[model samples]
Target chain A: MRRSERLVAMTDYFKENPYTHISLPFFVKWFGAAKSSISEDLDIIDAMFEQLGIGRLQTSAGAAGGVRYIPDYDMELSKEKIDEIIELLEDPQRILPGGYVYMSDLLGDLKQLRIIGKMFGAAFKAYDVDYVVTVATKGIPLAYAVADVLRVPVVIIRRDPKVTEGSTVSINYVSGSSRKIQTMVLSKRSIKENSNVILLDDFMKAGGTIHGMVSLMNEFNATVKGIGVLAEAEDDEEDRRVDDYISLLKFQEVNEREGRIQVARGNYFE
Target chain B: MRRSERLVAMTDYFKENPYTHISLPFFVKWFGAAKSSISEDLDIIDAMFEQLGIGRLQTSAGAAGGVRYIPDYDMELSKEKIDEIIELLEDPQRILPGGYVYMSDLLGDLKQLRIIGKMFGAAFKAYDVDYVVTVATKGIPLAYAVADVLRVPVVIIRRDPKVTEGSTVSINYVSGSSRKIQTMVLSKRSIKENSNVILLDDFMKAGGTIHGMVSLMNEFNATVKGIGVLAEAEDDEEDRRVDDYISLLKFQEVNEREGRIQVARGNYFE
Candidate 1:
């Protein structure tokens, strides 16, 4: 392959496989090129990703070291994305019955989820997350999106035991938002012990779900390194079960009768 | 920018934004290059994607023509993935109580999901999919995977109405596997009218969930261009509700007491 073609192939490989290490020999063997040429190609790709504030490629100079792709979005890019999310949340037409903003469209949106996922991934990328955890239903996509970029598996907690998942470890907790006692289950084998986990969800209200996830992670002997939500509702501020987390968008108020919404940037930027 | 560097940026851009068109002038403006030069860079990318089974770049002729990227995996690569999945599924350790295999690990696995997502993306690339659809829960990951590859949005159906989603269109359908009547809801604005949708899920046992999704799509007057599942259970062959679909892995049988499993390639190849 030509030098131009090699760069394209190299970028694709690294982007597809983030947080993965590939030896220089692998590239050397694949391209049938000298070590120097491979290094030049890496520098070019690394510079491009760095310049754009997307991520970076790192080289290990030792015998076993190759290159690893670390995807991250800088502070400025993150702020822009959150601002856009807040704008989307403030759409009056999105105000549903009660105080809920229509998040399914945002959750279901491919582009929207991608941005959210990337932002969350960027936030937790430094945590060395071994698994991305979330409860079943809405949070699954957000969890998967984070796991996708981090190149880690996602452990989806279920409200009910699934027949298809085999044996599971079940736990009971009071939902922070609903204030209802709920039973959630995880496959006994879903996560390995001592793994580092990042908990993510689409919405946070009183943080019953996020609190439940943190407790569940304890059962696996895994550490909850970070917590993130696509949007956090400030309704239950006094009743919130968990503190010390990041939210992309803050829902200050949603008036169904008035057809008004007050939204702002989340703690992620702060 | 030089041709080599421009090729890297263009490849990354198209890879990130598949199934979307970019005009020549847009590239010229971004890269500070001439139309002819931009065309040459696109050709370089088009060749790389074609030579590899991963994706393809197309050149549109005439006034409105620019370039579009379509990502797909080759036959050899697809086979390797399915074969690996079959091997993984065949493990007796995966057999769960009540004949359920422990797939949370596989489903939650980042590497595994990426492969499945890319393969599914390739299979349905020709569908001109407007949106990727799936019922909430386990199938969400599979749905997002396909959507990411196609550069389209994902429409997730909720098992129950969510206040945060505003008004929803709920439908009652009998789950093919459970044979129980259930209600699944979707936000009114989740999917646009007359959309070409591809329905995906993690497992298909009688495809009750998939059937529900297909029915839900009808409510929106959307077309079910294709149906893809990560795995399909052969247990309910006689009473299966839907027949026309694609599956990557086939679950031949699972013996709960004996701790045995049987898996094979799905109908995708056939």
Candidate 2:
């Protein structure tokens, strides 16, 4: 009704429905405001969003023109978040048996996942991602988080097939770490043909899983527009199968005997 | 910043960090605004949130007092969303072989998941929930969605234990439909003892998986505060293992031969 009220309501709507086009008439009718008032409201929200380092409301000019919220995080803010995550990963208590660092805690944290997802979303924001794809279990949350920011659906590839999935496309690939053949399955109806996809994973070692995903994308005639991982572990240069991708954190070492760990910002910063 | 700018930034902050208390001074320092101005800005946002039927900002009094956003959806609005979902589920094309419904499209949708998660969050808002728990794969997104709204972490139970999980606690339980014994494994450090949790799932048939989750929660001495499912199929009254839970959709019938599907709002409305 009022200017302040309209600002709050419009801000919430834009946040909830990012990348969704809302016509001036739609807002005018919804809020019982004039078209000019709606336009002014958009400008204010857009300016504040930029000032807050979130993103901007992209308004196109034409008969089909409307405003859409393009979510983003400032590069500086993203770097700060990555530094915070690196500090968390460096904790010695996170060292597990063998050489694996315990990151399930961070993975399970919604706050951390949001930060990681937004960073990945920012990294891959240039690509036209139809669906955020990831293998099941740990990668599901990360995939959804990125998809949420991109305003796209998340297509999860499962390790084992299930009845509810209906018809599926299954692929077998070697595990990067264990070099054992493993299976990844997706429902045939999950993605449209010739669509663009962004592949995401929680962790990457030899990049086998990501490589497998790229191959699977080929099966559906979909393009692998981007690849992003939350953390990448050190592996031999020759053993690393996938070369091009973005990562937020790097795991340098994990000494189980001494309960020590080393981590740093991923190549995205570099 | 001015009132309008502060309104936009403060609204974004409240939406991002729900259920987390922020002292009035924090806003003062962050926005470079006077205490009175910050209070007025908060009042404007709080009033608009209620007017929008999203939720209210609860402000406490005294030295330990501040504001926290408690998100909620209007019951009438939630019903409209449910009806829309019912229409989508009722499409005949969703019928698969073996009388199964193809819902991966809906499950993959971030918009649908957010609405469903908010409904579940509102249902369990009265309870003191420390975590949102679900089994791996399809339920992971729903778990994260609900956890995001509740401002808590998610703990996923794997179908099989992994070496990366460190020490795990596992239990064998019978599958609700197939009557086959299955195992669910969780990291020992996932859930703190005596914590409260809300169980979530994509679908439920005989509730065996949920039943198993309840058993596992007992091992950790945790409380199952609430159980929410996206959909539940019709099961024999005697076959239903778990009785106390909330579901958004109910699958009444699926005739694969005729490509017919029947769906309706779940018991939450009833």
Candidate 1 chain A: minimum summed lDDT over ten consecutive residues — where? A96-105
Report the lDDT tens digits of candidate 1 across residue range A184-243: 898888888899988888888888888888888888999999999888887767888889
What ranges in model 2 sit over 4 Å off? none
Tens digits of per-residue lDDT for model 1 on B48-119?
Answer: 887777877878899998988888888888899889888888889887667777777888887888788888
Could you tell me which 10 consecutive residues in candidate 1 chain B have the lowest summed lDDT? B95-104
Q: Per-residue lDDT of B10-48 in model 2, one digit per residue for the tens?
A: 899999999899999999899898988988888999899
DockQ for candidate 1, C-alpha atoms: 0.79
DockQ of every candidate: 0.79, 0.87
The TM-score values for the models, in the order shown, are: 0.96, 0.98
Model 1: docking quality category? medium
Number of the top candidate by TM-score?
Answer: 2
**Local distance difference test scores for all models:** 0.84, 0.90
